[model samples]
Target: MPRSEYVASIRSRIGTDLLLLPGVTAVIRDEDRFLLARHQHSGLWSLIGGAVEPGEEPGEAVIREVFEETAANVRVRRIVGVYGGHPMMVTYPNGDQVGYVTTAYDCELLSPATPDLDELLEVGWFERDEIKTLPRRTWIDRVIDDVPRGSV
Candidate 1:
């Protein structure tokens, strides 16, 4: 399920027009490392996450996305931040535009396995020092910055 049926329907009408969407991101941690996945299209590494489905809570969405993208079961320990606004907006290669109001969570990883879905090219655990050097977007960096300050 690359894009949800609901989002697909909306995109059919709006094309590349920006959609204000709810999303969730997980900063999964084990010991001193955090989990990140390479986006299939962008090839940039970022935290595991995806759009929040209709009727799904942010916490539920992160858990689902973690398993869907990493084949890992995780429990949400706490929320790191609620980020939105223009800075978090994204334009996909296929001309799908979305401004995501994302709830980023600090999650406890239960397992490490290859993704069950095809959205990610690879997955790995990275220390904070290494995460700062990755070719990721500002939104992802913001999420990572909050991990040490403790989830708020």
Candidate 2:
């Protein structure tokens, strides 16, 4: 997984110190299905999203991330929740640590797309019940549980 230039620069100065960065998570729902991606870094399925880039709004970050990982365009409908603390802490294989203050959004898919294989192993829509059977981390479970069914 390639770190964003912004994150790379910060890591250059701080090394492996935990950086509390702003991030976003997109919970894109299209009727009975929700979008998910199998992230390369974690090798676990998760909601579509990524870091909130410098100067970008949280909503903008969600849109950018969703497109980058899934090649899917989306409109942020409403915030599902804000999350942080222990569950948001991440330590990469290289030992770089991060604590993300993430804004999870309920989004509406607006265009056709599929998983961007460069960033993800796979991407697909899943029924709510089907999510429990997918490979994921504990935090991923909590994030999915935070989203409401049907619509945001």
Best by TM-score: 1
Instruction: Report, for every candidate in turn, its global Cα lDDT versus the true structure.
Output: 0.82, 0.82
Per-residue C-alpha lDDT of model 1 across residues 15-109, encoded as one tens digit per residue: 88999999899988766587788887788888888899989888999999888887789888888898898778888888778898999998887
- For candidate 2, the 10 contiguous residues with the lowest summed lDDT are 143-152
Error of 2 at 148 (Å): 2.7
- lDDT tens per residue, model 2, 1-152: 66989999999999999999898998777765777788777798888777888899999989988888777788888887898889789898899998988898988888876878777888888887898898875566677777666645
Q: Which pairs, if any, clash in model 1?
A: none
